[model samples]
Target: MQVALFTILSSLTGGHVRILETAYRYPRRPTFLIPRNYYVKLLNMLDTYYEGRFRDFIENNTVELPPMEITHFYAYPKYIYDAMNRIKGDLSYFDLFYVPHEHIGMMMLLKGVGVKWTALLQLTPVIGALDVDLPMNPIRLMSLNLRLNGMGYIGDKLFEYLIAKAVLSGETVLSVSKSIPYEMRLMGLRARVKVLDPGIGIDEACFSCGDKDIDLVFFGRLRREKGVFDFIRVLNVLRRRMRMRPRALIMGASDDETPRLVKARLRELGLSGLVDVKVNLTRRELLSNLARARVFVYPTRLDSIGLVVIEALAHGIPVITYDIPAMRLNYRTRAVLRVPFRDINSMALVTAKLLSDEEYREGLANEGLRFVRRFDWVNVALREWEELGKIASEESKAPETKVANVIKAISIA
Candidate 1:
C-alpha cells in the first residue's frame, strides 16, 4: 500500500502534512504530494464556501505555502464542502464539476500510478466539524442528530447529487476524527474513515522537551475564541486565591480580530502586568517555553485538537482546556482538567484545584507524560499506514512493530 499525507495550501493542512512525514517512519519513505495551484484554487474557492466564513479568512491571511507542487483539488477543502453542500442542499452549483470529482481524480492518479491505496490526512477542526460558532447544546444537537439514521439517506442524497452533478470532491479516503468516521456511515458515504489523533510532533529526548519546573507557559495562537480573555480572568482569580502571582507566557501569531480583542480584554482585565504575549517562535523556542512551565492552560471554545496540549503533556506539565471532544479524543490527561466550554468560573475552579493540590497535580503530570507517549507520531503514523493497508486488503501483509519495543528504543536509544 502507498500512502500520501495531504494538506491544503493553508497552515492547517501544511502543518499536518509535516507532522506525518517527520513523525511516522513508513516502511519506505512516502512521497510528499503537493500542488500549489490546487491550494490556490482552494483558497480562491474558500473565498466563497460558507457565506464567507472561510472565504473571509482566506482574503485576510497571507497564505504562504512551501515552494512545492501540491496536488490539485485533492488538498482543497472547499471543493469537498461545496460538492457536499450543493448535493445535500441540491443547490444549482451542480452546473459546476466539484469536490468528489476532485477526490476521484486524485485517487485515480494514485491508482493509475500503480499505488494500491492512498491515505489522505484530513485535519478536522472542532469548529468546523462540530460547528463551534453556535452555542454548545445547539451545535451538539446538530452534530448528534447529524449522526443518526435518516441523516445517511439525507447525506447520500446530497453525495449522489454532488457526484451526479460532477462536483467530484477528491476525498476517496478520509483521515478524520474518531467519531466522524462513524458519523459518515449515517450520512451514507461509502469511503473508509481512519480516525487518527492529530497532535504537533513532540520530541521526548531533550531535557527541555518535557521538563516542567517553570512558573507557567501557554503556547498556540492568541485568539478570542481560544478564550484568552477568560485565561486572563482565571489569572485574576488565581492572584486573588493564591496571593502569589504566576508569570505566564503567551506564544503564537494571529490573523483575525481575536488578537485585537484579546489584547483589549487583557488591558480591561488589568492582566498586562502578569502576561507576556509573544508572536511566532521557532519550534525549539516553543518547546523550551513548555519545559519551563508548571501548567498549560487553553480554555478554547473551538479546537478539534490543540497540539499544544500534547506538547505540554509530553513535558510532564498539566493542562486545563474547555471540555470538548477533540481534547478528550486525542489525549488522556493525568494532569489536565477540563471545565465546561466557555464557562469561566468552572475553568478557574478546576484549574485552581490542580494548582492547589500539589500531590494531585504531580500525579496528573505523571499520567500526562505516560498518555502522550502512547500517541507518539510514530505510532499514529504507523496506524494510519495500517489503515491504508486494510483498505488495500494487505493488513496481514503489513509488519507489526511492537509498541513496547518501539517505546523502549525511543526512550533509551
Candidate 2:
C-alpha cells in the first residue's frame, strides 16, 4: 500500500517534473511541480487558501497501507472511476492513512472512497488559505494582454475561497514552506500541519549533463521579481568592478511575462551582446547551461523560496541571492551570500566582492556543495515518507492526539 502511494505521487502527479511509469522521476530529480496553468500568481494564491477542510479525516475514517508493502498500478479512467473501482475496502488494512491534494481528480476521489485517516500534501498558498491576505495575482488578468482575443480573465477571490475549503480540511496538511504552517493556524487550524520541503533533489545523479562548467547561469520566468533586471545591473557592475571570471550569462526562461521584460532590460542595459538568453530549453539543456556556470545569480525577492535555488547549489555553484527563508534554510551547505533583495547597489557590491575574489568563490562553492547535502533527495525522502507514516499511524489514536503527534513528527523530521 505504501509503495502504491509513493509510486503514484512520485509518478503521474502534476508539475514540470514527472516520474515515469517505472516510478523513477523521468530524469531522476527528487522534485516535482503540481500540474499547473500559466496563472502562477493565481496558483500561488489557491495553494494556501483552498483549504481542504475535509482532509483531516485520516484516523477512524479509513484504512492505510504500511510504508513498504503495497503494490498495484492503475492509471484508471479518472479519480472518480478509480475510487469507485479500487478504494471501497475496509479501514483495518491501513493502520495509518494519507491523502495528498495532488490534483482536482484526487480532491474529488477522496469523497467517493468512503475512506478515512488520510493526510494530503499540498504546495502553494492560494488554494486552501483564501482568507489570508495576498497580493492580487496578475496572472488572473493575463488574457487582457492579447489584443484580438475576446477572452477576458480568469481567477476570482470568491472561487479561491471555495477551493480553499476543499483543501484546508485535510486531517493532516503537508506543505513545502514554513509559511504554510503559519497560515494554517491563522486560518484557525489549531493543529496538524507539516512542512517537508523537498529540497533540491539529488541532482548530480539526475541532472548530470557531461561535466563541463561555465561562468554563470540563471533560470526562471524572465521577470523583475526574479531579479533578471538586477542580474543585468550586476553585469554592468562586473564590467566596472570584477575583472576575473568574466561572465557569459546563460539565462533559461520559462514562458512568462518576466522573460519578455528581462530581454527588454538586457537590451536597454546594452548587455545584449554579452548575455546569451535561451527562452525555452529542454530540461537536459537547462541542466547543461547550469553545469557551465561557476556561480548562479538568484537575486530574487526576500520572501520567495523556490526549489530552483537548491538545484543550482547542487550543481556545485554558489548563489548570490537576497537573504531569505529559502536560502537561510540551506545556509550551511549552499554557496550563498544573502544580500538585501532589490538593492542594486548592494547586489553590485556583493557581485564585485565575490566574483573578484577567487578564494571566496571557491569557498562558496565548497560550502554550497556541502550545504545542499542535507537536501539530497535520497537523504530527505525517507524522512518525508516517515513523517507521513507517523501521521497515519498516530492519527488513529484521537483527534487532539492526532494533531499533536503529526506536529511532533514534523519537528523531529
Candidate 3:
C-alpha cells in the first residue's frame, strides 16, 4: 500500500521532525509532501553540520525509495488550500495519508475531499493551555488566548473544532504519549486513541559516562511554552538564592523572536555570564556537548513526549523537569526528578542537590540509562508500521465492520 505523508520540514531539530524522519526510514516508505524549499534547506543543514559524515549519516538514517516526484508548494494555509483543490483527485491514488498535528488544516482538507487518512496528534493546544501556569486575570487569560491561537496557521477555537471533529469522525488518531488522550478527556472530548512510544533513536556514541564538567543544561526549542524563561529563572535562583555558581548551557533552535527574548531575560536576570546560549547545533554536536553536563534541566510544559529528555537519559544524565502530566505518566522512575509545576525555587534547590551529590546523581543516571534502552528506533518504526498495516487492511471492509473491528482492537489493546 502507498502512503502520502504531509508535514512542513522547517527545522531538522525537533521531536516532530525526528518522527517524520523515522517514518521516512520505514521499509514501506511514504511519499513526503513538504515545503518546496525543504530539500535545499536540508542540504544546507547537512553541509553545515555533518561536513565529512554527510554521506554516512544520510545512508544510515534514510532508506532508498523510488525516484522522488517533487511538487513545490508553500506552507501557508491559502497555498495549501489551493494546492489541495488541484490535487484532490490525485490523492485517491494512495491507499492512506499520514498527517501530523501541525498540519490540521491539511487533515481537514483531506477529510473534505473524502480521502482515507490518519491524524497524528503530537501536541494539542488544549494540552498546552492545561500545562502552562497562566494567571486567571483577564489580561493574562487574553494573552494566553493570543499565544495559543498564534501557535499555528489556524486560530485556537478552529484548531479545537477540527480536533474534536477528527476524533468523533472515527479517524485513526495516534498520540505519542498517554498524556495527550488524558488531556483531551479533561477537555471533555473522548475517543479511541492509540499511544505510540517516544520514537527517537539514541546513537550508541551518545551513551557516554565521561567527565561531567558542565553543571546543568537545557536543550529544546527556545519558547516560553517549553519553559526557556523558566529555565533562566531556575538559573537565577540557583546563583542568587542557592549561592551556587553553576556552569549552564542552553542549546536549541528558534525561528521566532524567542532568542532575542531569551537574551533579554538572561541579561535582566543577571545570568548572562553564567549561562551560554548555543543555537541550531547538529544532533552529533548537541549530544557531544550534552555529555559534559551533570544534569539535564528541562522545564518544558509543551512536549507530548520530550525527545530531548530521552536523549539526556541515553547520555547517562539525570533529568530535572516540571511535574507535568506527560513527565509523571512516562517517567515515574528516579531517573527524572519532577518538581511541582512552575516551582522555580524548588527546581533550583533540586538542581543544587543533584549537582552536589555525585553518588545520588550517578544512581539516577544509571537508572536513566537502563530505562532508555527500550526506546530503540527500529522497535518504534516496527510498531508504527504494524499499526499502519492494520489501518490499511481495514480499507476494503464495510464502514460499520471497520468501526467494530477498530473498537475491538482498541479494547484488546
Candidate 4:
C-alpha cells in the first residue's frame, strides 16, 4: 500500500513537524507533499537536528518526489484545488492521502478530488476563537478580528462549516488529545474520533538528572495565546509579592512580533534582570538548555498535546501549567501541578513553593521521570504507522466504492 502525506512546512518548529519527522523514519515512508520553497528549509532543519535523516530517507527509499506549492493559509484551498486538478490522473497511484493536521483547506481539496484521506486533529482554531471560558469583551473581540484579518465571525463560521463537511464526508479523524473531541462536541459537531495514545514523544536524551540552576523555564512558540503574557504576570507576582528573585528562561521560536512585544513588556515590568529570552534554538540546543531548568512553567491555552510539557517531564523537571482541558486530561500526574486558568497569583504561589522546597521539587521530578518513559518516540511512531497501514489496507479493499461514496456525501453536504 502506498500513502501520500500532505503537510505544511515552515521555518518555525513545533511538535506537529517533529511528529512528521519521526513518522518519516518508519519502514514504510509516505511520500511527503509540502510547499516547494520550504523544501530546503526542511532539509536544513533535518540536517541540523536529525543527523541527516532526510538524506537517509532518499538513500533507503530511492524516491525523490517533486515538491508542491500550497502554503498560503487562507488561499491554500484554491491552490490545492488547482494543483490536484493538474495531477488528477496521477492521484490514483496512491492508496491513501494522509494529512498531519486537520486543515480545512486540505479537507476541501480532498473533497473536490474524491480521495480516501485521514487527518490528525491536533487542534482547531474554532476552539480558540470561541472559547467560552475566556470572556468575549470588546478588547478580546478586537484582538480576534486582528488575528483573523477582520473576518473573525466569518472565519469561525467557515471553520465550523468545513469541519462539519469533513466529518460528513466520511474521512477518518484522529485526535492527539481527548480534549479536542470534547471541544468539538461542545461546539455541537459530532465527529467519530480516535485518540492516539502517548500522542507526543521526546528524544531519549531528554531524560536526565543534573545540576538544575534555572528557577523557571517557559518553552514553545512565543505567542500571546501560549500564555507568554501570563508567564510575565506570574514573574511579576513572584518578585513584587513573594519577594523572590528567581531566574527565569523563556526559550522558543518567534512566529510574529510577539517576541518584541515580550521584550517591551519585560522592560516595563522591570523583569529584564530576572528573565532571559532565547529564540529559535535547534532541538539539540533546546534539550541542552532544558536540562538545566528546575521547573517548567507553561501557561499555554493553545496547545492540544503540550509536547514541551512532556519534554519537561522527560528531563526530570516538575511542571506548573494552567488547568486547561488538555492538561487536566493528559498530564494528570504528581509531576505536574495545575493552577486555575489566568490566575497569576495562584500560579506565582505554586512556583514559589516549588522553588523553595527542594525535597518536594525532587519528588515531583522523580515522578515525572518515571511517567515520561512510556512516551518514547519509537513506540508512538510505530503505533501511528500501524493505524495508517490499517487505514490504507481498508481503503485498498474497495477504493472505487469508498471514493464514490465520499464524493457523493461531500456533494450532498
- Identify the leading candidate in terms of lDDT: 4
Could you tell me every candidate's TM-score relative to the true structure? 0.62, 0.60, 0.81, 0.85
Model 2 error, position 352 (Å): 1.6
Q: Give the count of colliding residue pairs in each prediction.
A: 29, 67, 0, 0
**Can you tell me which runs of candidate 3 are displaced by over 4 Å?**
50-81, 85-90, 125-129, 132-163, 166-168, 396-413
User: What C-alpha lDDT values do all the predictions have?
Assistant: 0.50, 0.47, 0.68, 0.71
Model 3's alpha-carbon lDDT is: 0.68
lDDT for each residue of candidate 3 in 1-413, tens digit (9 for 90 to 100): 78777665445655555655467557776666655455446556666755533334333433222222333211233444555555667667788877756344455445544567776777643334346434464334434544642444224354444344443455666777777776666555455678877645655666776678889998988877778888898899888887889999998877788888888888988889998899878767787889889999998867767888888998889999987777887787899999988789999989999989999999999999899888777777777777776776665422344333433342344
CA lDDT for candidate 1: 0.50
lDDT of 1 by residue, 278-328 (tens): 664544555667687877788765455566676777777889886566566
Candidate 1: regions farther than 4 A off: 1-6, 12-24, 36-127, 131-176, 182-191, 197-201, 205-214, 239-244, 255-260, 392-413
lDDT tens digits, residues 241-292, model 2?
5543355554654555766676677788666777777865544566667776
lDDT of 4 by residue, 222-268 (tens): 87778888899999999998899999999887757888899999999
Worst 10 residues of 2 by lDDT: 68-77
Pairs clashing within candidate 3: none
